[model samples]
Target chain A: MALTRDGPRSLGEAATGGTLRLAGYLLLGVMLMMFDHRNGWLPRLRGAAAMLVQPAWRLAATPGRLVEDARRQLASAAYLRRENARLRDNLLLANVRIARMQALVRQNRQLKRLLDAVQSLQMQGQLARVMDIDLDPFRRRMVINRGARQGVHVGQPVVDAHGVMGQVTEVLPDTAVVLLVTDPSSALPVVDARSGVRTLAYGAGRGDLLDLPDLPVTADVRVGDELLSSGLGGRFPAGFPVGRITALKPDASGSYLRAVARPLAHLDRSDHVLLLRDLAEPFGPPAPAPAAGPPAALLGPAAAGSAAHPAPALRHGAGA
Target chain B: MMRLDGQRVLFYLSLALAVLLLLLPLPAALRPLRPWWPALVLVYWVLEAPGRVGLATAFLTGLAADLLAGTLLGDQALRLTVVVFLALRFRARLRFFPMTQQALALLLLLANDALLRWLIRVVSGVPLPPPLAWAAPLAGAALWPFVFLLLDALRARLRLREP
Candidate 1:
């Protein structure tokens, strides 16, 4: 009976077809998986496919927009009036801050000129719009509207108004994915602005908090210490405000303290972000090079004065 | 009997529309409860025309779904193929069952899909919430009767013949 059933009866033939189809599907699945994992050809294919899907996405988003409009219409007139007044007050506060920032910029320019800066590094960046958030909650990834076509490249530092946000990880033709600093995978070298104590800050995956590891238990770090990019890691330019120490707790296991810092950037609120270009290099050991200049010429007066100011010690004490 | 060519085209078009619906930007609050529209449509087609809608077709549709959702490839394909295969294998018995019983079966099928998805996510180092994720199956089951009635009416109106 088994042999007869297995023989090429009409039903057996159909079953064989089913088996063949499954085999084909399995083969296709393996090929697709390999291509996607390798990411060489798949990204280009995905970009092309994205263009095809764009129209469908636009149509689907229409309903969401309509719903938003309807809700706004249903809102009470009194609520709109209150919102308007609140916006006006916020605008006034923002105007004051802008004026102060402009003055500070002018002062910094004059000071730099007086210091006789030689070959100053000037980086310019473009503003990009946030396209989508990661579907998986565990991944702190976001897609931006700008992509390779818009000069966005992988590893470019992205920032919001306040401070460093993250870096671009994947670049497509029309979109790029940014891994936010709040992601557990992200790490940045930061320094205390006042004291110049350099430390590495790692994201704890909490929305706005970063953790500084390996601080001495007796370290003079305190709450409210302003943290800025150390520029030790060439990924980010020096002096960009990163975060501020918000809490400190001594660990019982060792002589180290666990410090939590809140990011200066408003990760949830910012709609536009700047992708900084023209950073020297990323955090890596310096390459060996031939000495071409005198020690005094290499270590200029500005460098000597900066080293003389025990800013790191002062910052540690103030933070503590 | 309904003409197979026109019906096939209509089926594919509806499948496309269902996929688009799945891609729509739903409100955060409602997103969790968003119906697995593509899965439901796939199941309907598989059950109604098993000859045309087979494991391979199910897998391809699932692949499309994975691509649209930005999930790991083959994840949805595996689930969808399993679901369609089971439905096709039991179509004779399933078609005889009452709508409520059929709904219960659908609930079980959807639960299986969700369970597989959750396991895959866990294996991929993602955190999984508790059993509340199974709520979609219950919702899908409740919706089964209305979906069946609507699709059945359309089939009857079009004089569709079972494959």
Candidate 2:
């Protein structure tokens, strides 16, 4: 090493070597960025690296977990008792609602039979815990503690109680990355629940809002109307609540309307989330069978909402 | 040889700790205040142990960080490479600066990194990061003196144990 470095030509050689290496690294970095941006040619490599570094994420999350545990432990026993009683009462009320829902579902099936409409797929949701780490601030994404090992795959919808969240983008062995509805790259197909007018809602790069761009100026929409997933793209299941229109105004071009909305799901505060799997694609197209032949175990496409399993009644609409 | 082995161990441990600090979740209000942990540690190594950490080392550390953070794979790599290159290129003049001046220089370097980050975000079609993100360089600069002192104490103790 000394002989090579201490040579008379060392000064010139080192400068050239450093410059060449920097250029080569820069070139490689640009190529990598392109590949990653285009979502091409790097998933396998990233997945392998993610698997290897999974322990690091665990290590980083430990302190937050400990703090949460300590907070729970320090809570007064009286408070815990009150919380338990409240939960029990809520459960009883929910049970009554479920009983009513079951009857309604049975009646709906009879109507489907009368109309000879296709049987809808039943939704069974699995609860996944969200990881406590924040990702790139510019990107609305989060890590959930469920992955390929738990039957999670890319494009599965995630939702909390209040409304649509997002779909899985990358799945590792034990964790998956969920791109939230507010990511600029994300777009959700939504229908105005009152007017039945369908449009696409794009992420506005903010946590609380989504944008509906390029709407015809005379479209029927109001500031307070609720938006539900249209399920047109087969990615999100139809009828899941998305957000409520907050503002509607003319775009700069004046030929189209720009509508803004406030998402119904609690974007900032959520923990356990439900992952919805559309049995249609996984179970080879919904079986066209008699309505009486045991309720269909799956349904249309998947709609994802942000954070928490607060909407078990919606996602777990099976067992009816 | 034994001393060199100990130094390597210390270097790796310091890098790992910096990574852990970077990964720690900050509260929403405090997130913008997160210091550039890994880069600051990398600067220390490049300034003090030029033989050990070079461009390739910085790039690889960044790649690992990208994978762990689930960010664009080369984003951090490019940022770290530029930082290490500048630090190495200016090491002779930088090594002798007093604490205040050193931190001022560091502010410039970190600001360069922040610029690269903004460029990457725009070019990659991501929305502009919040304005608060620019404060991160200030946070890193504010913590520089303490980081330098702590790492210096650790390095000094390691050297003292050399027999």
In model 2, the fraction of reference contacts reproduced equals 0.55
Segments of candidate 2 deviating more than 4 angstroms: A1-17, A279-320, B1-4
Question: Hey, what RMSD does candidate 1 come out at?
Answer: 10.6
Question: What tens-digit string does per-residue lDDT give for candidate 1 at A229-258?
Answer: 887768788778899999888877878888
Colliding pairs, model 1 = A195-A311, A195-A312, A195-A315, A221-A320, A222-A319, A222-A320
Give each model's whole-structure lDDT.
Answer: 0.71, 0.81
Categorize the docking of model 1. Answer: acceptable
By TM-score, who's the top model here?
Answer: 2
Give the DockQ of candidate 1.
Answer: 0.23
Chain B TM, per prediction: 0.87, 0.95
DockQ for all candidate structures vs. native: 0.23, 0.47
Whole-model alpha-carbon lDDT for candidate 1 = 0.71
B1-163: candidate 2 lDDT, tens digit per residue:
5544566788898888887787787776776667878899999987777777878988988887877776787988989998888887777778899999989989999999999999998898768877888988999999999999998888778777764
Candidate 2 lDDT tens digits, A111-141: 9899997647577798998787767656778
